[model samples]
Structures are given as C-alpha cells and as structure tokens.
Target: MVGFEMNDRRKIGIGLTGFGVLFTFLGIIFFFDKGLLAMGNILFVAGVMLTIGMKSTVSFFLKPRNYKGSILFGAGFCLVIFGWAVVGMIIEAYGFILLFSGFWPTVVVFLYRVPVLGRLLQQPFLMSFFDRFTRTERRVPV
Candidate 1:
C-alpha cells in the first residue's frame, strides 16, 4: 500500500523553516536589521538541512547545475554577516528563486490539494501562469 509518514524530524524541520520565514519577514519590516536577518538565514539553512538531511543538502547545493545559485546564496550569506543586509537579502532572493525553481511544480501540485487555497490556485488564469513557468526549461548549454 502507498503511504506517507510524518516523522518527528520532518515536523521539526517544517517548524524551523516556518520560523525562518517569519524572522526574515520581521527583519525586512524592521528596516533590515542585520541581527534578525542573520538569524533568519541561519535558521533557514538549518531547516533545509534538517528537512532533507545532510547528504541530500550537500548534493543539492553542490550539483554542477546548481553551482551558480549555490555560490550566490553563499555570497549573500556572507554579505549579511558583514552587515550588508539589504543587498544580501536581494541577492539571496535571486539565488533562492534559481535554486528552488524546479520545485515550483511540485509545490503547486501540493497546493492544489489544499481546501481553501486550492480553489483559488486552481483558477484557470493562475494555473496557466504556473503551467507556463513550470514548462520552461532552465538548461545551460555545455
């Protein structure tokens, strides 16, 4: 039988990720407070690692196709640490989009299963937009 399990580790990971997002939002609201932003960044990375495990996290960031995003993300973190919160967050946002672009479709699929949000997201216009985005290939010519 097909099944899914919600283990403790996964639950903790999800909680951490949610907190990371909250802290990041608060940082922006607080005029890009460096301390909050740094904490957010740390929590976000830790959440991802815990969510996927160390091996998977390393492989994901180290993959040749993801090198650009990985590098930018790392640089952004460094910038944040060095007190350039605004610029670092901007760079991190771009890097985040690049890194998680492939996950959009999966996330959309999951969203479609939700009760309230599903109806909103399933509208033809929204679905079309998401479909177009997910269909575009992001390959680099060797």
Candidate 2:
C-alpha cells in the first residue's frame, strides 16, 4: 500500500535515472580499461540524456500542459541509443539535433531565472534567438 502510493511516472523516472547512472559508470570503466573511447563516450552521453529525459518526463507528468519537451527529450535519447547500432554518425547527428532542440530551451529558461546569470541572458540578440527557437508556437510565422 505504501509503495503503491508512488505514481508510475516517478517509478519510471527512478528506473531510467538509475540505469542511466549505471550505464554512464560502465562507459567510464570501458574507456579506462579497454580504451574503447568512442563507444564509451557515446554510452556516457546517452546515459546522461536518458537521465535528463526522465527528469523532464516526470516534470511533464506533474504538469501535463508542458509535455512536448519531455517527449522530445525521451525520443532524442532513444534515437541516440539506437543510432549506435544503425548508421552511427548520421543517426547520432540527427539524435543530437533533436536532443538539443528539445533540451536547450528548458536550460535557457532555467538560467534566465537565476539572479546574476539572468542579467547576462537578458542580452537582446541572445534573448531574441532563444525566444524564436524555444517558442512552441511557430517555427516559421505564417
């Protein structure tokens, strides 16, 4: 009964974050022990993104209106993981594009809320670009 009180999303987030940490650790070990630098780096990056996606997804679940970012984050991590098996470079590139597209805006927003850093982020050009890129409304105005 007590365990059941926790929602599914929380469970999922914990699971994903746990696996991501494990994979990241393994990636580091692989790099150090076997010198599989490229593979290790890929695994590490994917794990970090997976953990981030889990956080985003849990956040989205708490506030359903803002679900798109979580979806994109999860999908991006999946794509990056799958890219390891398929076309390698190209798929990874696309995955990274999707990942950044989904993740950067949230980061910008968070940074903008900070005290001192917010001032720096208030610069016109950067804010304009951040607004345009992160806006969920329209990529190209009609």
Stretches of model 2 off by over 4 angstroms after superposition: 1-46, 49-90, 136-142
lDDT of each: 0.85, 0.52
lDDT, candidate 2, 46-123, per-residue tens: 444454455653554345543444454445445435544223333444644544465676677778779999899789
Top model number, lDDT: 1
- lDDT tens digits by residue: candidate 1, 1-142: 1353667876788788889889989999999999999999888898888877789899999999999999889989899989999999999888988899888867776686789998998799998886776554322222
What C-alpha lDDT does candidate 1 achieve relative to the native structure?
0.85
Worst 10 residues of 2 by lDDT: 32-41
How many backbone overlaps does candidate 2 show? 0
- Cα RMSD (Å) per model? 5.6, 9.7
Those runs of model 1 whose alpha carbons end farther than 4 Å from true positions after fitting are 1-5, 135-142
